[model samples]
Target: MTAAASSAGIRLRDHPAFILFWISRVCSALAFQMLGVVVGWLVYSLTGSAAALGLVGLAQFLPILCLTLLVGHVADTFDRRRIVLACQTLSALTVGALALAEGSGHAGLLPIYAAVVTIGASRAFEAPTMAALLPRLVPGEVLPRALAVASSAMQMATIAGPAVGGFAYIFGPAVPLTLAAVCYGVAAVAMAFIRHVHAPGPRSAMTLETLLSGLAFIRRSPVVLGSISLDLFAVLLGGVTALLPIYAGEILHVGTQGLGALRAAPAVGAVLMSIVLVRRPPTRQVGHVMFAAVAVFGLATVVFSLSSSFLLSLGALFVLGAADNVSVVIRSSLVQLSTPDEMRGRVSAVNSLFVGTSNQLGEFESGMVAALIGAVGAGVVGGVGTLMVVALWTRLFPALFHVDAMPVKVETRR
Candidate 1:
């Protein structure tokens, strides 16, 4: 498709590949969200230990940090569609096995942990490829809208998934696992029709020299570094996913239903923001907006921490989600537009690493802090830390504050 042809808002209904990818994403996201809740509950239920919950986050993230670089190389070198299909297929089968084990009453801690590790490994490959291929699906001008749509769909799935999963646990965790397997199966099938391909370029020499090249680019690219660092610190500190269960059960005095709402609240807010952004593009002063959103997220987290009422906590979480989506949309679009096509996979891999560290490692941080200082105290302190980081970052990265257009050229060494 010509770039001009794609500049027009291609109705999502008419785009078969996009529709397929969207449905697939929603299904898989729902299943993944459910799987997260089930695993957290299972681990905590089995051991009755906060440390066990932290271990769950560790097992999921450690693999991504270890294997993401290799996966990025593969993404740049191969057809992204095939890579996505293969990863989805393997993940589906893994989830299927989990479902089977659950049905037979054989689901144990070891098996569950093994399954999480396998899924994480598959994600290490899938995420980078998925991120890189997004541009090919739409024109550059329309990329933001497409991303917002995609993000909204995923958030809707997240909002629904955990709620359903939590309710299903009444019957057994098996029911939710079985449903998750179905979602994965459907996603694998939908992924089959994604025709976007990453044509190969001249083979870059494989060495530490080549791998370090991306980092060098990042160092010189203040815009990229600043955007990523903002996310890294803001999410790393303000993140409260690991502590939600404590608030749900203790402070809120609600059961699994409340936990489900807590899990879904952010996504609901994100979806709402995404819908609004589709009509209005983020044009100028995006860096300032991004900073403001991160600060809002921190403030919301603070409110959530102090709130004893379930409804008020949920409202705070919703605001956090909305602000978070704004930051995500801007930072993600900046990264994609600034980085050259040849380096998308590697850059995306690095991006994924930052995201994994912020989220998974953040989970561990929240869990450990909650264990030591209590959930409310830990969350409040984390929020304060995020605000501090934002203040310091703005002062340090002046170029980031001035960024307007995505840079066309980025020099990298082999």
Candidate 2:
């Protein structure tokens, strides 16, 4: 496809590869979410310890941290689609084994932890490769819409997957694991169908210099550093998700059902915002807009912390989700456009690392703070901290703050 053929006014659905991309993404996302719900339940039920539950997060996070640089090189050097497919296939088989173990009443903590580690190791390869593959599926101009649409699908899966897992577990633990295996299998097959265009210019030998190159690139590029760090700090401090159960039970006086609604509210808002972006994409001043969205997310967190009315809290979460989608759409597109294709995988790996670290730590931070000052106070403080991040980042990285156009062709070294 030529550049002109893929200019503005082109919908992502017009591209066959882009369609397959999202199908694969949604399926893999659903599988992961479903697996998470089932695994958390199994580990907790077996050990009955919150610390054991925390270990599960550690099992998942560690491989990504240890393999970040190496995997980025792999994505840049090898076929991304094949890597993603292989990883998901491994995940499917591993989760299927878990299902078998559960059916035989042999799902012990050691086996479960081993399985979680294997799945996590696969995703360590899969996530960055998949991210690097996306720009290849669609033209640069349509990437914003593409990211927005993918985010919408992922959020939908995020909302539904756990519910499906919870319901499937009623049949047996194996039932949900089996379902997750099917989803992973489907995701692998969908990825097999993608015909994305990737041109690897050259390969370099494995060395300390090559491995740390992504970090070097980020440090040198203020726009890259600023956008990603903004996400890291803002989300690290702004998250109140871990405290949702407390709010639903004590403050809002709603039960488990209300907690479900509160959890789904952000996704609902995100999906709606994605639809709007698809229709009318952002045209200008996106940096300011992204900062504004983060601000809104913070404000919503604050309002949600203070509100006693269930309805009011729901509204806050809804707006919070919508605003977050806007920032995500902008930030993801900008980062992709800024990087050269050869190292997109490496850069994307670093990007994935930042995101994963923030989310995990965010939950830990929220839980600890809530324990100390109570959930309400923690939410208020977190929201304020997010606002502070936004304020400081604007002055810190003027390039990111002043960004007007969506596309940036960055120059990088070998």
Candidate 3:
């Protein structure tokens, strides 16, 4: 497709490959979100400990932290689609195992943690491989729209998955987990239907140098570094997702249904923001917009921390999600547009590591702090920390702050 043809109003839907890819993404996202809700609720209900909840996050994060570099190399050196299929298959089996264990009334914290670790290992490979596959599905000009569409689909699933999981939990904890396994199974089948082919790049001998190349590239690219690190520290400190169960049960005086609403609220806001971006994609002052969005996100987090009313907290989370979607779109576009195609997998792996840190490790941090300061104090402090991260990052990375447009020329090795 020519650049002009690709730009003529949301032509991503015209591509079969993208459609299949989008379906796979939505299915996987829905399953993952549901799994998160089920796991958080189950573990907390079983153990009644905030630290146990943090440990769950840690279990999921450890594999990604340890294997991401090797996974990045594999993505650049192999068929990304096949890699995704294999990982999804593994994830399906893991979730299925959890469902069986739970259904048998023999589920323990250890078994659940083991299952989470397996899922994390699968995601370690899948995240980078899936990211690398996107460029093959559509032309560069259409990428932004494709990404927005894909994100919207994923967000829509996220908005529904938690509520579904919450209600399904009333049936049995195993019910939601069983459904999550089915979603992963469907995603694997969707992967099988995708026809895009990516020939492996030149294989270099396995070495420390080859594995660390993605990190080196990011360090040299100031814009990518700044954008990623900004997300890293901001979300790392500001994330209060880990404490939601505590808030829903103890503070808000709501049950499982309300917990589902709390989890789904952010995605609702994100879906709305994504739809708006699909209509009018940001083309100028991208950096400024990203900063402002994150600031708003921090502000929303603060509001959520202080609000005792369930409705008010939901509203705060909604605004938080919307602000975050803006930052995600802008940062994702910049990252993809700036990196060389040959190194996209590696760079994307680095991006995944940042995401894992911000999310999983951030969850751990929230739980730890909440254990010390209480959930409300943890949220307030995290929100303030997010705002502080923004100010520090802006002063430190001036290039990121002034970035005006998505640079057409990809950055090359210096």
Candidate 4:
């Protein structure tokens, strides 16, 4: 590592609160990832129906879609630390219940689906609350590096979580679920250790205005709107997650094992890019950097779609992941830094809504498109669409695209 990067790491290590938060985040993320792999495998094994697997994702997402406004309100009104702890505990219990059901031979499709929806609901609460708390744990100047370091949970979860769960599944499906429950438990405990638990400031009652405040806050800020929406439209249009199985099975002709590698490739790229950001956090022209990253994301998708060779496809996925990591780090830092302590939860919930929905919706979009044209054609179309979003977003949210520095903080209007 360069001396400067090494120096940055040491400074970050000085904050004990961030350390605890990071630990909790890693544990929580790992639990979620483990649960995901096992659930998919178990569902597919039980039903052997592709549509059933699709329903599993839909089941998880529906709660988030339904609960977005309420979840954000609760986060803003209550103690974020306790909120996160409670949600993690709930996840542990719900997943544990699923594991017990499996062991007892009562783990039917309905039981699994029920547990997934409950877990999803808890996550909808956990994610935004966690995000709202991060800015409080570190100083404004270091927030970018802090965000980069925190992205490690995503990187670790993306790469290691499934791999660990898959290995544990060799013992039995229940094993991974059991491990996931344990991880959640650990996450809850770690969250409890955070020193400064924020109590939200005095606010208006839970009225229609209060509920819609988050969306309003976002809409008023062109930068926030642009960054968040850019991610939504870009990923919603560009993501090829739903097409991976098809590629592994038919297009790439690599089979299930190949699918595993393909799934991990983007994450691997993300991890590498995150490390670079931690070492040398973006300081200027971040707007340009993010747009470029999104463009690369699009270009890589296009290349991957056109590639016939498996090795070339993997390389394309690697580039795609790396580009995604850059844009995500920049966007996340910008959002948290710009939002106020009081309104962070609400705004973050809206952000979460876009991010959370976009993944599944993107898959759904990709699947629908592929059904009509084919996987390769669908990918190419999605990539081009992402590039078009970049062009249009630059024109629409000029402040974000031309920004030289991310906002340090903003006071929300009540």
Candidate 5:
């Protein structure tokens, strides 16, 4: 590690713990991406409606949202590693169950929904634990780079998963479900290899007051509050992932394969951006960059709404993904660096809530809007709404606008 980099914080490459953690995270991410494409295809095929797709998203996200506070509290007070292991085991079982159900040829809507709900419950526990554990695995200085790496891996997975899932669906829906089970099984094994990680600090006491402390912590931190809110609003209004099936089947005249391509498009852009971000970190005015990126994301969505050609729509979504990734990197780095170690899990739980909202709620918004106004019109309106949100956020979050990326200096463990 360079002396300058060391003085700034831990170098990501030099740390054994960080390397292992990164690898495990990447493997899990690839598995997750494959699972998503398969699940989406399964749901849509069964119901033949965009609203049904939104329901799928809702079932996955609702548990995460509802249990976030408890999840965060548990993360802060307990053994994070054990928490992760338990959740991973639960996740693997759910995936296996999904595979079994699909294979049986008797997989009803309720059964699928039940499996997803179990997966959702697992995530409610896992997300905060995983995010909080990253800092322990890596030195503070290279945290941003580490985050970039993890996000990039996820993007790559996104690129591969849907493409694979589409092909699997061609053979049989059961094929994709079984593949997802295998992926989750691999992820579970990979997680088991992590060792020697320390737990979070001891908790004072378990009480209703302690459970609510994470929320209280956010209320006092303007930077955290503003950044979280900015992400929530921008994504909620602008995201159109839920409506892709509608666009795919009706407007674009593309089949399941095309839908997979549509899903892969953003991840392609995100992966490309992640690679670039690795070499050239964002400048000091990250907040400004965030807003510009989000605005561009919105504008791209608007363009996508108007595009009749499949290629043109893909190009627009690519741009949107590119912009959104930049936003994600910046916001996530800021969130991680700004919070105290003890509070990282709770803060991350809060982040999960916002992100989950952006995803599932965005899906709901897109689905309803498409039902009411037509898919194309709904996307256009959502994009415009996103742009307005960016303008409002600029006015509201001066700190976020001016905050520069800092080298994460890990204070020596107590």
Candidate 6:
């Protein structure tokens, strides 16, 4: 490594709170990723229906949709660390319940959905708290690099989690679920060690106007709105992850191990890309880069959808992930930096809603389409839709396209 990069690494490592935060995030991500693999496979194995897979996504998303505004308010009004600790504990307990259900051989779709709903509620609270907490852990100048490091850790966990879960399935379906519970437990413990203390904001009365503030802010900020919505539409249109089980069994004929490989490919690419970004952060035309990267993501999705060969599919997924990492780093930095400190929690919650819509709702869309046509047809159509979205979004949000650097200053109306 260059002397500058080496010195920066030393600085990052010297911060105990960031280290602890990073550890907690990695453990939590690993647990969630493992739980995802187990849930998707088990749901499919039992029902043998594509729509059932979509239901799993819906089950997790409903709570977020219902409680996101309230959750954002809580994050801003309370101690962010405490909120994370409580939510992590809740997630651990939910996963433990899932493990018990599986071990008892009484695991049904209904019970699984119920457990996922509980986990989803935990996520709805946890996401904004964590996003709001990050800027407090590190200096403002290094926030972009800090975000990159955090993303790398998450991608690393993503790479390992599914592979471990898929292999653990050999012992029994419940084994991965049990392991996921253990990871969440570890994550909770790590979160408990974080000593960063954020003063609670003045509490506001619960009201419709207060809850809508986050939405109102995003509506007025063209940069934030454009970046968030671009991701929302692109991923909603192009997401093929919900169909991995089908691809593993029907299209690719690769079984469980191959399913694990398919899931990990994107993360592998993301981790590599994140490392590069951390060393040499984006300097100019960041908005353009994000747009181009997303377009590349759509193209990669198209290639993956058309490929029948395992190696070819993996390559496409790797490219897709690499492109996604670029968009993620840029968008996350932009959202956090542009919004004021007091409003970070609310804004982050709004951001999370966009994410949930893209991921969970996208899964539902993918499943319904796949059920009607076929997996390949759904993938092709989604990829095309994603490209079309890029063209439309570019036309609609010129401010997003013209942004020149990270840590952009935007005028916000309070």
Per-residue lDDT for 166 in model 5? 68
Q: What's model 4's TM-score?
A: 0.95
lDDT of each: 0.81, 0.88, 0.85, 0.88, 0.78, 0.86
- Give candidate 1 regions above 4 Å deviation: 1-10, 13-15, 41-52, 169-174, 249-256, 370-374, 405-414
RMSD of candidate 6 to the true fold?
3.4
Best by TM-score: 4
TM per candidate: 0.88, 0.95, 0.88, 0.95, 0.88, 0.88
Candidate 3: residue pairs that collide: none
- Tell me the tens digit of each residue's lDDT in model 2 across 1-414: 122223434444578777777788888899899999999999999999999998999999999999999999999888888889999999999999999999999989999999999998999999888888888877787788778777877888989899999999999899999999999999899889887467554677989998889899889999888989999998899998899999999999899999999999999999889878876678699999999999999999999999999999999999999998998899888888888888789999999999999999999999999999999999999999999999999999999999998884433334
User: The CA-based lDDT of model 6 is what?
Assistant: 0.86
1-414, model 3: which lDDT tens digit per residue?
A: 223224546454567787778778888888998999899998999999988987887888899999888898898887789999999999999999999999999899888888888998998898778887886777666666667777787788877887788789999999999999999999999999998567777888879998899899899998989988999988999888888999899999999889878988898998888777777777788899999999999999999999899999999999999999989888887887777776878889989999987887788899899999999999999999999988988899999998887664533323
Q: Model 5, range 161-269, lDDT digits (tens) per residue?
A: 7668767878887787777777666666667777757556786677888778778888887777877888898889898898898889999999888987898899889
Q: How close is each model in CA RMSD to the real structure?
A: 3.9, 3.1, 3.7, 2.2, 3.7, 3.4
Q: In terms of TM-score, how similar is model 1 to the real structure?
A: 0.88
Model 6 worst lDDT window (10 residues): 1-10
Q: What is the lDDT of residue 88 in candidate 5?
A: 70
Candidate 5: which stretches are off by over 4 Å? 1-13, 37-55, 97-111, 169-175, 249-257, 410-413
Runs in model 2 deviating more than 4 A are 1-13, 408-414
Error in Å for residue 283 of model 2: 1.9
In candidate 4, what are the lDDT values of residues 337-388, reduced to their tens digit? Answer: 7777788899899999999878978988999999999999999999999999
